[model samples]
Target: MVQHCAGLPLAIVVLGGILATKNNSLNEWRKISDNVKSYLKKSKNQRPDDVLASSIASSKQKERDGGEIAEDVAESYLMELVESSNIRSLLFFNEFFPEEALEKSLPLEVLNYVKEHEDEVCNPLVCIFMISRAGTSCLKARGIWRYMFNNFKLLRALNYEITRGDHSVGFKLPSDIGNLIHLRFLSLKDLKFSWIKLPSSLGNLRCLQTLDLRVGNYEIHVLNVIWRMEQLRHLYLPFMCKSRTKLMLGTLRKLLTLVNFNTKNYYLKDLINMTNLRELGINFPFNFENFNEKELGENPFIIRSKYLHSLSIITQWLILSIDPRHLAHLLSSCTSICKLSINYARISKLPEYHYFSSHLAYIRLLGCEFKEDPIRTLEKLPNLRILEFESSFEGKEMFCSAQGFPKLESLILGAYYNLEEWKMDEGAMPSL
Candidate 1:
């Protein structure tokens, strides 16, 4: 039977041992029955039995005789094995069965066998865990989640991918997900949870360092909860709700190396508060009018950022009418900024009365209109190396004077509607 049931090696070993003990006598058969009964009567240590049952239960239905395993018999044997002792010991043998073994379809009876032994499938003591939907009709089958959530608590790294036939189906997360305090990494990608909201308790995963939640159209309201996790170093949230809501930016200020932030409507004050931020990317409309320019003007936007080296701002429109002096003051505050990008801005001309910084090395102007000579204004940068211009400009004459850029290295002139000629001295002609 061991060699014949090629798919279930562990079950074959255990059941074959019992069969060998029975020899070929009715007395041995009676002993085997009694032993199985006693094994079931023992404590809830049937992890091995549950694993064996799931392995055997998932075996291809087609038998050696070209017939499928009878659903009733498969289910009955699985139930009997699950009720046996030494179930918890099965968690140690993840290599016993090949991954392909669970790919085959099983009978409904085999599914019922798994459903009955669900508790044994996931043992908190076992480092190796398995959850199979091969025979189960629904994910909500009794004891299914209990086994999963309980076992998840002990996992150091978890990769759970469950497939429901229907696209509209949404899986509900167990409320006790926070119990996985030991989890350091978690990945949930290409999943459908449109109807379910992430539990706030997930914030309790204090030890988690990496979390990737890249599901589509799933609305998550746990930003506040996520903000409280001080130990989190990397978070990948590619998709989120567009509805405006106040985010807890102040909570993330403590992260010294926070490199990426792909969110919208985030309070600028909260972002400005993160003194240690490096690379930052934000996509959403911001109402500059709401910024407390008067009170916060004492400490301008750039002044608070001592470590900020790169900044990118994208929105529908940029308010150019902002007090140029205030804008210049804010720009001068960032003593360390090396790269800056502004998209859809209204400011066409650079302010003449402003004090410029020497650290500004690169500037990218996208979809913006200028009222004054942009090139002449950009000429103030003694250290400017690269400049990119995109979209047509209302001004016709381009500023290419020697005094404009003494140290300029690369100049990309693009999409200027009525550009006639670049005015520059022969000595100031850039090598490019």
Candidate 2:
């Protein structure tokens, strides 16, 4: 029967459901097994792919435009047939598949299967850790969960893409997750809860290397535990406003990448301690202190991060307190930045005709209004290979200088609804 299921989890679930409805008599199960064996033997010559494709198409139609199917039909049918069924036997029979079957299936398939029938298989899904693979894992839960932390002990990575059911207003995860001693990578994405409170035991994941969470839209708080994940190499989260907890960042010496860093929660001194950082993404708050040329020169984090390669800044547009020239000076401090992306910034002018970062090779600007010809300054980047401008400038005419963008390979000028004249000088972009 396991072979007949062909290592497909969905097929196994359906077959298990069918058996769950039958009486727990040896003869009953034997008859069903015999019938399945006989059918497989007789149909050995049939194309399984063709049959499976047909079955998938039929299932899709009944599922209605790829949306959730009604579970009432499945539940009512199971209840009618197994009103007196033994739950223990059902649990026992569910593990008929070989251990290798669980390991071979992709994590995405397991997540989908569990989410599809969460109403029916939620308990079994966690009780049998067969759903999670050893190295990398993903699970999506809609309601309160208790056993997942206990079962996912050996995982090296876990991405919890959790959602809230209609009745669920707040979400909380078990502190036992700290027991996953081998965990290294963790992420939480697309969470929809009024407030998410992380357990203090989160500080116990000493081996955690990567922490990624999309916590901007929700009121996610109490994340001081992050300071304990000392080995974190990559951190992806939006600015957390109104936090008094200070990070013991010197312990996180291995940190190399940060995404959407909030200046409000941290200070330049804190960033200076992470001197090994490479790639960074920051949302420059409107109230951020302006840095003078002397201060920018003294900030070792920005001036001495020789490994810094990619930088993304999403500027706050509601207030324009800092002069645009000072912004250029701050970027120039990152002498090694190669790729830069700026969004929603209100820089009205470029400082001079010289490129800000000597090693900058790629640039992407979005929703920034430039008061003058940006090309005059951008065309001077010696190592620039790709330039993309999206709804960034209001100028209708742009002129490129002779022998400009010496090494540029690609240029994408998109969403410039007002651009009318683009004039290139003789020998302009000669290497293009």
Candidate 3:
């Protein structure tokens, strides 16, 4: 039944999933094949939705026979679908939240909704929680969040970010948040508040798969319960933590995108466990468990993740602590990375061309204060196409040799205040 609609993505996914489950077990594969054949013989007009439903029902029957572990395996199938680049980005318009009711149900649809309906029962089906930027939203959001936690048990997605437009009181995350057991996605980013008190009950969200906790404030007390979210795939941590934030993440084999990872919150050696990671963002002033700041600045450990494709680095402005050697050693491990962003780093020149990834295509340098010609090594990046510099380099003149940037297409330079001349030879950037 699943394979009848052979060319369609729906059918392909259904068939591909069954193959993964069977995994070299011909007996299991034959059993599933027989089950699919039985379903197809009953349906006359083969439709995608009908075939899809039959496959799901068949999967459920197997889960019932195989016990509770099968249920976990079913969830893993869902994660596989989410991880697939082909299906992940496809937009399912209002699949959860109704388009017509969204205007009336969204908590912050109107700027005055929170103020007007402090005790209002928001539409229970509301999935996306985007509160207005109004500062007053923070005060009233407490009751709203609590209500949702207690009521919306099966809610799948939630996003909350209430800026402190004029309010001074901090937002307190309700401990009852653990009650949201079915929540798969949650984002609390850009809450422009003074402080955030994270509840320990947050560990109860075992089903959460995607979590973003990057608030604007620097003071965020993140409990070490994140290791419990074994299903987490994309995790965006805060830019900085309030106190010591230690987490054991060796079990998160499914994690793919990790942002704002620093040694203070995580063990640097634990990175090797996330072999499936594709995108990573880290903070600077490399302070690992055993390495002192001075030691790390002198000789940094070379990261080794073969699958990482994107890397974002943000160096703290604390006494200009980062060195070019530190970044050189770090980039050597991420040879597969395609996009690189270096922000507020202390390096005065670009790293050697050999340290850059072989797949590097785009680079954005901000506040690096490069005095030498930043293009010397960068222009040699064979795959580089887009290069952007924002107040990143300072010099009286810059040079680009002939045939240096063969694949370059876009070159952007901003805030080059002291630049006196830009010298590029013929064929320096043939693609531009």
Candidate 4:
């Protein structure tokens, strides 16, 4: 199923959602597959862009002969991908093209979408994407989104990236954005701005499933409206944002991938509700403020999901603020993690073997500088396959017990200049 969409996440969602409503008959599915192949394989020699370029040319010719003007066409094919009911998923692809070439035609096509479709008896739900091409002229992109917000109320996916050069110094999300009740995906990632704040009206996007708020070159303040998106699956906050940008997410019970989360803005208890979460990332300065190490052992903060396979805690060379026991109990809570990565944690010692996840297959530690030998402790992990250490030890002697690392396949040690003695028992690391 993943391979069929070329492993593109948006394509997977769009195709999967479309397929869910189809009949289970194999013959019927095979016929639909043939049409998909024909649509994608327009010609043996034509690349995807070539097919797109040809599509614009064909749409323009059709428009001249009295067909729909914005038949998912741009004045130049590279300018914009117009929305078509059948090919709604292709417009949001991250493609880079010059904005100067299609300056005149971009607005005309966008403004005409509502005029042509407003009177249609029963139009299918559609999606529209407005990718901000670098070097876009300021005058060429004005009033485009205003038109979209005023119209296109049935839009499902809207990926809009605006450049600092394209808009005025102050930019605000239009209140009408809340009217997009049917929207499933909304990505404003890579918007170059100074300071932008999400409006309270954004909570009206009750049906949104994917929301990306990553911004470039400036800070964005997200309001607490995300808690209203009860249907959200994948949520990405800004890579960097205002310090006190209080946002709540406890209601996202069905969330899958959560990125750029720091302990600063959100509460740890909120994680208890995301039972379906699979991937989670903690951004810089993962603060563990007001922690009690002794109490942590008695009552660990267990993340409820057993499906979480990857865990990452990345910081900017800052030492971990919590004690080693805090990390230990935290690791013990995640019993299903297969891979673990921590950088500059300053824990001084690795967690006890019993505290580590038994399912862990790979581990990487950087700059932790464990005061004690980690080999003896970590070697007991029954399913361990790979172990990596970089500047994580400051010892002159190291030892591996007999019959240790039974299933290990790869071992890497780096930047241990103080090592003067090394001992491995005869039967240790036999599988290395």
What is the overall TM-score of model 4 with all chains considered together? 0.65
Which ranges in model 2 have alpha carbons more than 4 Å from their true place? 1-145, 151-154, 162-170, 239-250, 286-303, 315-322, 353-355
Which candidate number has the best TM-score? Answer: 3
Candidate 1 segments exceeding 4 Å error: 1-150, 154-177, 183-193, 209-220, 234-245, 256-265, 288-293, 296-303, 316-330, 345-357, 429-431
Using all chains and alpha carbons, the TM-scores for the candidates as numbered come to 0.54, 0.62, 0.68, 0.65
- Count of clashes in candidate 2: 0
Q: Pairs clashing in candidate 2?
A: none
Q: What is the C-alpha lDDT of each candidate?
A: 0.55, 0.64, 0.71, 0.68
1 or 3: which has the higher lDDT?
3
RMSD of each: 23.1, 19.9, 10.0, 14.4
- TM-score for model 1? 0.54
How many residue pairs clash in model 3? 0
User: What is candidate 1's lDDT per residue for 274-336, written digit by digit as tens?
Assistant: 655555544343334445658546645632646567666544333433345544655665567
Models sorted by lDDT, best on top: 3, 4, 2, 1
- Candidate 4 residues lying further than 4 Å off, grouped into runs, are 1-142, 160-176, 243-246, 287-297, 317-320
Candidate 2 lDDT for residue 87:
52
Best model per lDDT: 3
Worst 10 residues of 4 by lDDT: 121-130
Measured by C-alpha RMSD in angstroms, how accurate is candidate 1?
23.1
Worst 10 residues of 3 by lDDT: 124-133
For model 4, residues 177-252, the per-residue Cα lDDT tens digits are 8878899999877665433777678899999999998866566777778899998988988887674655778889
